[model samples]
Target: MEWLERMNRAIDYIEENLTGDIELSEAARMACCSSYHFQRMFSFITNVTLSEYIRRRRLTLAALELQHSGVAKVIDVALKYGYDSPVSFARAFHALHGITPAMARQDGIALKAYPRLSFLITIRGADAMNYRIETKESFEVFGIEGIFRTDGDGEAPQTPAKLWEQSHANGDVKQLEARAGVLPSFVSQDLYPVNAVCSYRKTGPDTFPYMLCAFKEENSNTDGYTTVTIPAYTWVIFPSEPHQWEQFGDTIETLYRRFYTEWLPTAGYEQVDGVEFEMNGTKNGLNYIELWFAVRKI
Candidate 1:
């Protein structure tokens, strides 16, 4: 319930500022999280990016105003909703409503509307989530890193998967795997296999750096990848049940969805400012993946 309140408060902030400049940071503050985490949580829970949600809501209101107000000018309505020019505004407006801003003034015209958002929970079947918490010493990892923007008018966050594919295609993954021990058979539990993502204090307004890498073993070779050090922190680890290799993606995604929706709100913990791991490997001829979220007791 508290989590719902924080999120709904954030929605209220967005709703109140629909006609003016809405600072995502302020909305995150109302939700008691960093801007990046808030956006991530929002996307996961709502299946919509925060920026796109805001855009839809703004356009919904602008459409209503344009349809009702006989005196409303297209340029003035466009500026009210943060578009600097009528052309850009019309482009966005038509994309959402399938009609132009000028057409919006025609009586009996149709427009799409996205109502304000509020967070709530619904009781489903007796599903279970598996997780553990561990506090470990600070560690260092080496890998290839790329900065990605969280907010845009694009598709869902596929950057992580894309990064993995790129590494595999370009021999980056092979290079690291060649020097590193194979999982389960030779790698220590401390060695996050080839799956760890890290440290933050949001690097940019809409961008965060994601790494495709592994824990730096003392004698392991680091010939090509850059190394990054992550400070000590507590992590909540969620492990999906061991399954066949073909089910890896679905299993991991379900685990992540449960982590944010079923765990974070009720578990009395919050994702902290540090590293996270997508700890994965094979054991007993079955593949498995775990999500390690750096967290603190709320």
Candidate 2:
């Protein structure tokens, strides 16, 4: 996260201009990256989407100004943040703070304040990651999936525990695993929509029936599991330390953020269409784990 210093600098720039026009292109320059790349990196590193963060921060400031300052006109506040009118700002403010601007101004409503972000590089290079880039035909995956939403940073859905419990109680997951060790995948869906985290198993591409996949096509041989054909692509494989299960989501998020925000820009790789995969070697205590991703040269 050494490069996070640049992110912090960018945050400072945002804070300084919350009252003025804040452009995505300008912010990208502050971060020393292109707008698309900066926005993507910002979402990954912060674990909160950039647009969401800005909206929250803006509303928080507006609420504070209403409470503590002399800005009596809602339209004025809205215009200051680039909103077209009071109605628009109020709508956005309600979405973020769960209350309309007028109500919040009069009733002292609670608001979410997104503090400026800071990134610090930590040195822990001991953990070994096992992964390799792969090139295969485009594929499809089929399996029953459940969507889980994160409450905020580090607040993932509890569905995994439930899914595992129900699957084991019904002996469905065990049966499925017995068929083959299918790897679970974490996918970013709906382009940063609230509660957009989904977990799934590979099926097949453009096939009538989809199948749940366990491990890579090479690892297992089983009857129930289906093979999905995937297009050839480069991949990055990372290994997790022995016995670190509780922090799986946090660790994965951190690594992915660093890989995208810090590593990939200089590493000369761009994401390609392929399902991201997570391999857990030891489920009982998390002795080790691996993450697989698809990529190609920029």
Best by lDDT: 1
For model 2 the local lDDT of residue 21 reads 73
Q: Give the residue spans of candidate 1 off by over 4 A.
A: 152-158, 181-192, 200-202, 244-246
lDDT per residue for candidate 1 within 1-298, as digits (tens), equals 7778899999999999988989897888888876777888898888888989999999999999988997899999999999999999999998999999889889789788898877777675688777778887776777777666656424444476777887888888878876654443323354335775844446765566788776677666877777787778888888777799889878977887788888887888888843467777766668878788988887
What are the root-mean-square deviations of the candidates from the true structure over C-alphas? 3.4, 9.8
Q: Each model's TM-score, in the order given?
A: 0.86, 0.50
lDDT of 2: 0.56
- Candidate 1 residue 221 Cα shift, in angstroms, is 1.8
Output the number of the TM-score-best candidate: 1
TM-score of 2: 0.50
Ten-residue region with minimum lDDT total, candidate 2? 188-197
Instruction: Tell me the deviation in Å of residue 131 in model 1.
Output: 1.4
